[model samples]
Target chain A: MSRRTSRWSVAFVAAVLTSGVGVLLADPHLVLLSIPAVVFAVYPHLTRPPAATLEIERSIAEQDPAHGQEVEVTVTLRNAGDRTLSDVRVVDGVAPMLSVRSGSARHAAVLGPGTETTFSYTVIAKRGVHRFEPATAVLRDASGGVTLETTLAADTELACRSPIRTLPLGHTARYAGSTATTDSGSGIEFSRIRSYRPGDPPGRIDWNRYARSGELTTVSFREERSRTTVCCLDAREICYRSSGDDSVHAVSYERAAARELLDAASDAGEPVGVAIFGVDFTWLAPATGSHHVATAHRTLEDPETLPIVPPTEWDGTPDDAQARELRTRIGPPTTVLLLSPLLDEFPLETARTLRAEGHSVTVLSPDVTTAGSLGRGVARLRRENRIDALRRAGVPVVDWEPETPLETAIRRGERR
Target chain B: MTGPIAIARRLLVGVGAVALCLGLLVLFGPPVESAIRWPWDDELLLVAFFTAALLLASVIGPFVLIDDGSQNQNQNQNRNRNQNRGNASPGAPERVPSTPTPGRELERVLDSRWPASLPPVRRRRIRRRLRRAAIRSIVRTSNCSKETARERLERGVWTDDPVAAAFVRAGGGPDSDSSRLRSLVERIRFPRRARRTARAVLSRTEEGEHR
Candidate 1:
């Protein structure tokens, strides 16, 4: 605790000096004036602040909350000493990123021995893990002449989970894979009957048809095989736009869609890989496993890997260098699922180039453009035209709306 | 700091006490002259008695006033404490309460509102906030990432608008030097429009000067 002389004390000293001088000059009036000063001087000393006896504790309502949810926090302070504490102030150390939604995180009260006070507040949680710092307490004497400050360490952590959901995939595979194929083969789903060859197994023979027509025939079943797939997400700056608050930026949607596709591919025992283009080129070769799926999620979720900001300038049009890089990284029997907002011509050109390289390409374009303004309308028209051009080139395009869920949009597109 | 009124009151009280002492001395002077043999000795004896009475009054008068004032103050304080306790929820911990300090409240406000993670210096904070805002706007307008925006800014790609680039290069870290420029940049409603207007004004002024 630190102490500073109060104005009352100073006034008393001045009064004493004046009275002494008056006495030396044989003045009785000055001696009368000094009486009040003496009383004021001694009054504060009679009732000084007591020794340290304050204790503090803090509690949080929820340790982990969903993103955008509010969490309430309470801080309690008690004085255990015999002397009354006239003034106490407490400030709770809230995380920087999380904003206090309602109520104050600070409180002040006067307490006697064995008395306590509590303050409560609420904060809106954000994505990621947040840790609370210690609470600070400032105590003062009744006279306000002395103050003692201390920090009460109460550490707590809150973790918020991601809001995105997994996406669904269609049964059709452009390339050979372990997943079910449309082609007829020896599989669970029935296909068609055909003329029996010499090498045909007897179990595949259609006995009922054979008995009716007096001919030997074999039944065909749909084939089930795994295909190598690559999910490429466009992290270009153009894809960072969002049309609504509930909707994330186009790049985030793309990442979510790619993650779902990669996870589905991995679960189906197919070799799947991921690539990101725009801010900085990143690629993971096609591989299938739980580890690979986790790796892909980490890469897609990494802000550094897929930056929210767009590049200031275009690197160049989709040229031979980009096509060469694609060819080098991706080999045949690999189907490419290109996730982009397709805001600019470069993404469309890149898709066409990838298709030209004989890869079965499907573009999952997250539509971030809104026709609320003339500029946005023009941009939307341009995007539609690009999608049309891609469709004309025989590439299936899923024009995913920003507000629509990825699973619903992909399923609807697959039906078409 | 004590106000003028308080000082005036104290001065008035001192003068009144002195006047009362002088009056008492004058009232008792004749009685003292009748009792003493010497004429000057009577005045001295009266003065001494007046001084003693004044001294006794000075001590006793303050004590009585102080005792009465303290009693009232204590009663009021106890009432307030009881009211405060009643306001709190039942079974809640007792609290030591005090009025909020204005200076400390202001400090807390500054601490909470200011970006603590950023550089502590005011000019540096301004520079960083402005730079980040400019970069974000560039990313939005140009459809580029933060890296590309920073690169373009450093290279002066937005030559049509030099304020942002100039701000980046304005090396002074002191608030006195940077605040004016910071405000100027912040006030630009539409950067592109402001740039065009600035160019037009400069060209018009040049033409007028040449003519």
Candidate 2:
């Protein structure tokens, strides 16, 4: 019901009416000039809304893609009504986080009855699931006087999954796994023979030794205990800095390493938990099972539970409340795998405090500091100094370079 | 000269001139007196009127035809040129910038190795870094404030190169434009399909010449 007056029509109508009246009363010469104005005034009404029948269908090239892969989305619009649409502008609603890699999500075309047009664009897949919104189409008549905006709903989902890889635990996890444990017991390696006890297992009785030595002895193997590890991620504001790309951010690397460690620990039948310290403050208690693994994945994937950006500045001072909170959550028998960029002194102090509290500490610091500029060079030096100080204090520290895989870095750190 | 209004004006001037000449001839010449005293009533007057109208039409007709012919020729020429531009090859010399000085720094910043296959988060970070650097470079070189430079860059005021300008505007993020630019740059740099596009572009211009 919305109507807009055309300026040309208004001007022409006014001129014709005034001239026609003047000619009737005074001069007949101006009567012939009003003929063109009458024709101009009738031209606009010839255009109609192009009947309201349109069918929109959306299709995605890949519903599930690896992170960093490109997905192409095509939207096909057909004119179902019995009319020709002169000017139609269609804009497909692309997810905000998904970047268009190629082509365009918009198209302008003229479609006749039963004719179809399609517009497509490529989007870079990121981690998480993205849903497409409705496409908006604006139909304009031939005279450009009438515009009808219609929203067409198109439901599509694109899920980007990150491939999980096992991270090298090195000498940290003492259990029966790919990595060897320092204190080996009940393993393949033979240890020593001890005097047989009355209730000793029949299999452990060294019959060959007893036959040779004539003294009753029992074979004892070193007992291998599955290592229970808690991954402590420092998602504090100070750990949010990136050397170059956001993907190369300190916290992102820490998160990746933590996930890998959790996967490796879970595979080895070791109890693993995650504690994210920041504004979000997410803590998962030590547990082992498929349910716990699913819970960890869910927590890591949820945007609310993870810190994407720094919420506050780290002043390099100790927060007693935070330390106390961490201490209460972490048990004594569990090894604390502290993953931080160690951007400031606070994380270093936290590592020191954890070690002092009799918890075995392994610090995996992702190096996001570059020495391209003096400021960054100083930051790198400060980070190195912190790593040195932590190592000197008997804490196993892994200073991982961003380019190196997490597993390789941990193995290298263990060897050192 | 070729428009409908121009043709109408020419026709009006031609008719006015013919009418004025006829009026002068009738006022001073013996033809008008002879025609007035003719035994055949108004037959002579009708013939003179028809003769004058024919003369006016003859004088104005050629100009109108010539104008129309020339207008059609010009339109055909323009259409051909547009078609040629649209069909130009990827290595077309015209696609290369004439003087790439303004975009040199931005190009260098964007020239960093950003592959499309990298994770979306990494790609976004790389794009953002390149964009910020480009904006800062624009501010420094153009002697404008950061806000003005950003606005200009976003609006594509600094560079005429659409891809380079788009690269600046699509600051590292998950937006469609940024993603498109990143993909374009990756293709241009690595070029699995169009491998010669980058080589053809760079080989034509000297590297230091841009600086």
Candidate 3:
């Protein structure tokens, strides 16, 4: 940005006034006095603003920091154009989600050609992948008559992924491990006795029945197989609400919780998938492997899939459409571990619909509602009502508070 | 520097400088001892000097002394833009867009639109939302029909908090003497009445939850 500071306009006016009075009075000495004023007025216009060419690079001490850890950021601004910048103000672009714990991100200095200036700031690490924005550099001329501002691009990011831990999936922990199915298969639990076929395993044959009745029979047992649990995240705009402006939005908490669930499920060697409903519906099919787990983590971390920024305009596709898509993608056999804030009634309705579809749905709602204001209080109560409704519908609702440990909330939900 | 305007500006500066120098020489230099020096020479020099000074003032005064309204407006606009941009600048604490909570509506009404000042349609809408929520809360806890919950709400038998009952039932029915007395008390206590009513409803819902 180039702007004229209107320097010495006052001196220019004074010079004109002095000259006018001197001419009217015919006093040569008075005219001579105005000469100094005239010089002061024209001095700034005599020198042109310097060419400001600068390059800035930012580096973080810990690229992948633990949650709440203080990470130091160093910014280096180099005067690359072989021209001296008199007054340079540089504001490093820190991710909005992270707060500066100590030090200043803004610095002002004068830089000569080939000379560099560095500033360091410390920011408290937050959950999520925070990418640094372009730093804003404002350069002012030596005379302060002109100012130029431009953004310096640097590819810097702090991927502060919270460590995952095993979470109790409430009553739905059955899905965390192998579940016994009613169908007869090769398992420990006896299902029934059937007439023996030639291909039947010899060990499965009921030799006692054969001896007693002179008929061959086979014994069947219930099938014990791992159930797939899809972490269906409600990233709808409504779920982006937070209790306060400075706090992380509910979607972030939900995202963190979803990752924990995915990690636990994969650790148990169960098939796990990730689904998100926000700007658009995203689905990752259930499978069991390290590659599958990595893919699920990538899906969870992808901003396009689950954006840290809330959607500006709703996708317009109603909740039913998303629920329908999720239902179709995740058949009845898959357990749905829904992560939502329950800010509105849609999540509750979706949970009920999913449960009605014969999918074992468990709701893990991060409580982002607060009692700061009467309106917020009402919002909290309304959220409580939704949670109550979900629980009454037999969908175990783990009402998670972001301030509390996720495991503690799950344990509380299990007790409930 | 190459534009026509720039060229004209340079020419003006040159002319002004020449005129200033000539005026200074005429004012301070030794007097001309020429034979043609007339009696009115001093007066003529003064008139010429005054004319040059007036011309210079006319040419340069407006440029330097006067403020440009358009430029000032642009500066103000730039200032506002800078402030707005600074909101997301480096080191600015992250802020999420806050969604309006339900009680905010009633809080607005109670704080700003008290008694009969609010538009009937808006007041009714606020009332309906609160009433519906309270009814659902009652029904959820007591396992009663919606109608019964609503009936209890209107009858002021839903909760022991009279102010809450009255706030919820505001503009719902005829004003009995006792109801009028409560409304008077509500008016006296004003802004907090709505909040109290919300608290009462929440508490009632909690009571049923425990049951």
Candidate 4:
């Protein structure tokens, strides 16, 4: 919109207007010719669509799904104007980690009467805060007139979390006197009490009970440690996506859970560790102190590229040696919390193996499998089977669909 | 290809548009000659409408060319590739940007040949993505034929997208696309299946008992 004056256009217009009276007025031929030329050449730019007028909205068909499932995205295109929109194409900019299929971004539509059109597509996200930016609708007149580009930052987001596991924490691990043990040393609930054994500790002995029992019967109350387990998410390109500017719900979601878990653990002073499975493992050995929790957070935050040594349990290759080596090098097992999409068998098997080795395993996998309408049933079945196996193996499971609050799922499962 | 199709189509739509515009123009334009009256010189009006229609189309000719978005695909891919790789730290040459990577010692891609000249930033991005993709592809790929590997790539099945996109985008210049990258990844000299098989066999209990 520099002045409506091109030098030639201005000169021509000036000649037509200021060429005073008789002789110029006589030659009206020039005026008609000039009008059509200018109109034809300049109409497009003048008629270009307004950038501010376009609005976009997006909805995730299912705000939640199992890992590796597809999620449908329904995008609404609204014309907030009096102008007839032609050649309006809308592309919902997706995060790089998602796989989008079907149809082109450039929609062919003639929306004139306060119109709204919606385009539906599907994608499978790993796990995390999946942001949906505004749809970029590139509008041009049917005659390729001035092209107008609109960017609507609608700020739509969907949070994908893992599925629930039925097994309790004790299923993942075992305690000799767990039943009457009251499991009080560190857990989420109150179990029970037990009689003093031969090696009764004076600190834990119920003095009141001792006075009554006529013997030193140590009062063993179930230890209620924080159900806070922080996972260390590996955001490095290799673990999930390979390149730069890539995002996977698995990476982001795992990182997100890890962050929350670490925060909760830190506040509650519980042990936390993360075994990053990328090219290798980035192990933050489980420690109970708040400092260790902070370390887990920092490790999760590290900008990815660092070489990671994966814990042996989740090794992609059927190589148990690595898992054996990791197991040997590791200290006392805390809860083995695996935050992944579980696209492959590695993470699941890792959880199973951890349980087999006397470690409590909790899997937080974002349900990518049950995202869309058609495949949801099958995905649900698969998810059910996975949960069943973990439960049968005595590992507590928490199945989460995307967009459902992770905390709610964790609490419900624990209570159950 | 792009504009004026609507207007042209409308006019040619028989009585609906032709009669409308011509009726208006004939009622309005200055008298050409006595042969053409102010209101109802049917032949003259027809001629005038046709002439105007031809003139408008001829005037709008050049602008009709549609610039298919294909032209910009390469430029976008290259720019993104570089932006991604440059973000990785220098010390970790094989580092992928987002999903984890820290491991002790591992076999590098072993590319002694200097890669074709590319913008340094883009090259770095490609290299990083390639490294990450290589590892991930190795992990994801079952020990199968080159055809199977290629099929997986074509399906866009890998979990690591940035690396895959970069690898695919970087392998071919303007001529490259996702399909092309899929093929190239399959052909990448590493016998990825062999390594995986070796690792698996070495880990198997049967083999372990012998060891």
Write one digit per residue (lDDT tens) for candidate 2, span A144-175.
66556666776777766333344333235544
Instruction: Give a tens-digit lDDT track for model 4, residues A233-345.
Output: 43323334222223243465566666566655554455556666554456666667766766765666454422221222333433344355445645455466666665444
Which candidate order results from sorting by DockQ in descending order? 3, 4, 1, 2
Q: Which stretches of candidate 4 lie over 4 Å from their true place?
A: A1-37, A45-51, A68-71, A125-129, A141-145, A155-160, A165-230, A237-416, B1-211
Candidate 4, residues B106-187, lDDT tens digits: the string is 1222222322233434434434433333333323334344456445444544333433333433232233345866545544
| Cα lDDT tens digits for candidate 1, B1-211 | 2665456556766766775665466446767334533233355565665566456556655654565457435433433332222222111112111111111211222223343322234335444434544444455445556688778667766444555456544352335456866655543322332233223323332343355
- For residues A224-340, what per-residue lDDT tens digits would candidate 3 score against the true structure? 888878898998877766666456777877877887787778777888888898868899999999999999888886767776655456646677787788878876566888888
B1-211 per-residue lDDT for model 2 (tens digits) = 4766556556755765665565455557866645644233455554554455445545545554564467435433432232223222212111111111112222333333453344555445445544554554455445567789789767976654555556546542344556777665664543121112222222212221244
Instruction: Please name the candidate that would achieve the greatest lDDT relative to the true structure.
Output: 3
Between 2 and 4, whose DockQ is larger?
4
Per-residue lDDT of model 3, residues B24-108, tens digit only: 5665665622322334347667677667766776776676544444655654444334333322222242233344333455556
RMSD to native for every prediction?
A: 19.3, 22.0, 8.5, 17.3
Spell out the clash pairs found in candidate 2: A100-B176, A100-B180, A185-A222, A185-A223, A185-A224, A186-A222, B128-B172
Ranking by TM-score: 3, 2, 1, 4
Model 3 ranges off by over 4 Å: A1-81, A100-103, A114-126, A154-162, A167-229, A262-275, A279-315, A318-333, B1-27, B30-103, B110-125, B128-132, B135-157, B161-196, B205-211
Selected candidate, larger TM-score, 2 vs 3? 3
